[model samples]
Target: MADVNPFYLGAFAVYLLIVLGIGVWGYTKTSDVMDFWAFGQEMGPWLATWSFVANFVSAVSVIGFIGAVYGEGYTLMTHTIFGLMLGTSGLYFAVDRVRNLDLLTFPDIIASVTGYEVARPIAGAVLLGNGWLYLVMQLVGASLLVTAITGVPYEYMVWVIGIVFIVYTVLGGLVSVAWTDFLQGTVMVGAVLLALGYMIFDFGGFTAINQQFAALDSAYVHPTGEGAYTAIGIIATIVAFFGTIFTEQNNIVRIAATRDVRTAKLHLAASGVILSIFYSALVILGGATTVALTTSGLAVDNVDSAFPVLITDYVPTGVGIIIILAVMSAILSTTDTRLHSTGITTARDIYSYFRPDSSDDSQLRVSRIATIAFGITATAAAVNPPGTIIELYNFRAVLLTSAFLIPVYLGLYWAGLSARAILASIVTGATLGVGTEIAGGLFGVPSTFIGVGAATLVLIVGHFLLSDTEPKGGTMAGD
Candidate 1:
């Protein structure tokens, strides 16, 4: 049997206790269906800021992103960061607009924007689909962290983590998720900074690490010069980042939870700045890992294992546990929100579609049931496991961004986009995106680009093709 570190286990237990305490408190505070799902639109800017940033830093970022940079080098960050900033700034513009609409669900916003009743259900289906895959990815990430830190069997860990996630989400809804996110987001940032500090101090210093990287290869410093990832790949990363930030329903719910339009905009700006700094720091840390690995003549079979190896090998057991906790935080931070979002989507989108007159109490009841059901299904899938965390996330990114990115953006900005055109755009883009992804990298372009291109083509052609008959009512017209 592998030895267990008492400090690690103790720390993990304390973290779980705190999270559960927060969930129980939030449950007590939740008075209505709106309060449960949207925090009653009373969230302060700081909490909203933390939750917004937390929404983006999933296990994929902690495990997959760090490893990618360690293996590939600078090009990963060059466009990826730019895309994140672009998306955040775009969302900043959307904050007031979204708040003003005061919709119950994200799909309702689409229906409002397009003046089409049909747009709601389409958006709902897409969000729920994305939520399922995303939940599975987070489950995989949590299981990986547990197995690495506790020497637990991966299959057992998935069910264990899955049940915990379901319980918290079904108990407290978005209110609990937001407060817990605030706590975890702070921990995640602190732990990452600590990890970087440890690496730098252990490896002599920044100067020493930089010299080691230079000694190894100059391509490590050049943005587009190293590894298998091409400029095209970078472009796809940007699109994924931009699309996810702009269109993801989880984020929309976060924004809706804020006090007002002004608070929402402030939170978005702050979250963007925070996200940029933290992610940039991660890039540097990844590069530092590359230097450390090369200088020590140590290597791991999988790049995703690089950070874990660095933590367990070099850092003290106490600090290493904190780092492990941070990874667990990263996994839970996103997983709970995704689970909650799925419940909301199922309740408001699917159940409401069938029974439009269902009471709020009834909706809440269905949401809890759906949340538990989705969590269990994702847990079952996690036992089998499919691929690396990043790969799974990237797969969903294309599928999600293609289906909703263009439609949402166009619905928000373009008055001429008809209900028919928006619907057609989502259908065609999603179809092409999934088909091309399965077809595998035809024409040297990523599936994301092809899918987005297909959507954009239909939007433009269909708009001009059907301009005279398009709907006249829009957000701008009423305003």
Candidate 2:
């Protein structure tokens, strides 16, 4: 069993109090729903970029990601690299486009560009489904870490984190979440760097870590190897990258929330560098765990759990306090923001389209309900904790690929991207994504690619067939 120390308890308590305090402070003066959802368009570069990267690299990477590499080797990192790069590039394409539209949600992006009333609601549903699935993954990931550090039951941690997040979110809205993320994100980044540094020295420095990696003949670290990467893994990564950036609401909402096209682009530039570094560290840390563990002969099956297990096993109680803080920071930073995203996505994009007369108060109420509902759903899914972190991570990428990839690009870039064309593309992609998942178990090849592959076809075919509208416009948000 895991022992919960006093220093760890005190550290987590202080972190929680500060977070709650900021949320309450922000809530006291929120002007409206826009303020609730987008911090009233008030985020600066530092706040916006930090919030983006923090939310981007959460519990999934910290716990789940490391676990994934431990099981699958460095090949997992390849998919992530491609997905990350493509995802960022995809965002860069849209930041300027969305910024100019000044949209509240991704649905706003769909409706503004597509000129279809129906696309707004459908897009919202697509976003909500994808966002909530990924959000639950984050929630479960956080809860597991909390339980390990605090000796609380996973379920209790889930509800505790869930309720606390809801309080500040419902109270301060985006104002509270963004400001709090900045503070929490800082803690998480600092702690991870510190932990990694300690790890480097503990192994007698980078020379030893590298020599161990090289001796092991781990092809996963060789970023240049192509064939060592499996066909399916690369496919999984490509589909995830193609679909997620455009489809997922969290990334898009951040983009849309920006003040202008230029701001959104800068946000992307900042996020690309920060997010890549953070994710790569997880891979390196995962590799290092083998050097430490294999020599010791511990029966470790899961890599994601490696970080937690390391703290308890090798690290002293005092130093473990920092790891505990990192875990808690990861849990709180990701979970609260996710609760905020799902509730808002469902309310603003999905619910409002169906219920235009819905008041801001009613919307706020619905947002809270959605948050609770998502938290409950995640708790249920987490009970099983199937496959690995990498498997779960791929789910979002899968959904994003089928539904959003081509439609997003065509919708944003090509003037011929009609609402009908986009809707068709979404249906086709979704069907293929579902098929890929089903086929993978039996045949060992993913069905998800069918949707993305066909959608790209649709993107090409749709352009010529949909031809020549006089100029609804060639508008974009910024650079």
Candidate 3:
């Protein structure tokens, strides 16, 4: 029996209309580079929260989270809770300082904190490297999702998502992504929760799902029954939350876009709590559904399809449309932000780094072009998609978190932290991060956790080793 109905098709049309309308409206207001890039730094708390939280919870959680719980179990959830707790709390100190700095990008913050000489090229490379790969991941996820849901050619979906992202980002910049996120994020959150409730009721009750989980159970109280609960596996669970809140350019940019420090603080604090609940609910729903399917003797290839497959195969017509909306909302919010962010990094961080005297307007134009080039590159990566969202995400998060997390953490608090320490923090963390990821496959060790541990070690040792040196410049973001 074919699962889809015309209702979804109609809903999709409505979604497209709303997206197009928002893009056009945002474009009309974009008059300069800052207007297109940072919403002219006029965002309030609510809008900033959406930009932060929605992008934080995207296709990766939609697919990878459930698959992780199903594979790793309660252990992963424990680690996730730890990481999120750290990230959400750490944001209080870190983000307020960032807000005070009057900077637009992470690169800007770094340059001010460490002196422009060391900060310029390294920050640019970090932002561009981080933004480009992350963009590719989201783009790939979008391509895979559209094709799976619609049975359309993956290329068509890629072009559609890429073009739409490039168009509005070039036109409206952060203003476009931020405003659009509020709408899409709301729809996505509501739809996901609604679907969870409906699915539980449809299955007869929690008892049914529990019985299935019991059968599949290992020692892990898995939020579903996955084996992800090992010592290091825990750290890997929600590393992205920590990684992005500090180092991710999009969040930094969004925070920078706020009108003042108070607004930035309000939005990020609110976003962290809201996003934590949202993420927990999503993983729970995924685990429960997988248990149900396994109980019924059905096998699913990728966890990304957990919600989508259930909607198409199990849910009623009306209910399914809601789920599709949720999925589309998540996809759109992430892609739009990524497209804009990658462009910002390329133009602001890399290209302009080489040419300091370039006009802002000229830089903005170059950013848009880079956006398109990166879009195509990302499309290629996502078309095939590397692995489940959680796994690929964990790999990226571990590497990124190790490399940047310490610098942000120390930079915000430890006032006497030397310039040499800051450099060591980045260098050591990055070196260990790569080594961990590469070693996992051959050595049969968990790379994600291994990398995090190694990075942590290097960060600590490197800092002490450089304790004697004077910071090359005055520290702090606004200095």
Tell me the alpha-carbon RMSD of every candidate.
Answer: 2.7, 3.8, 3.3
Best by lDDT: 1
| Clashing residue pairs for model 1 | none
Please give the distance, in angstroms, between residue 20's alpha carbon in candidate 1 and its true position after superposition: 1.7
Count of clashes in candidate 1:
0
By TM-score, the candidates rank as 1, 2, 3
- Candidate 3 — worst ten consecutive residues by lDDT sum? 470-479
Please give, for residues 1-479, the per-residue lDDT of candidate 3 as tens digits: 15335666667767877787888888888889998888888988888887777777676666556665655554555666557657767877767778888888777776666664446557667666666667666666666655666666777777777766767666677777888898888888888889788867866776665565666775436442354345544545467446655777887888888999899888878877887777767766765777766766665776555555666666677887887788778877887787788788878876677777889988988878887787777766766666656656666676667677767566656665656566666766666676767566325555544555665666567667776755555533322
Best by TM-score: 1
Compare candidates 1 and 2 on lDDT and give the better one.
Answer: 1
**Candidate 1, superposed: residue stretches over 4 Å from native:** 467-479
Candidate 1 local lDDT, 166-241, one digit each (tens): 8887888888999999989999988888888887888888878767776777786787756556778788878977
Relative to the true structure, how large is the alpha-carbon lDDT of every model? 0.81, 0.70, 0.70
Cα displacement (angstroms), candidate 3, residue 163, comes to 2.5
Query: Please, what are the lDDT tens digits per residue for candidate 2 over residues 251-366?
Result: 76777667767788887898788777777676777767666666666537556667677766666776678777776677666677767888887888777777878899888878
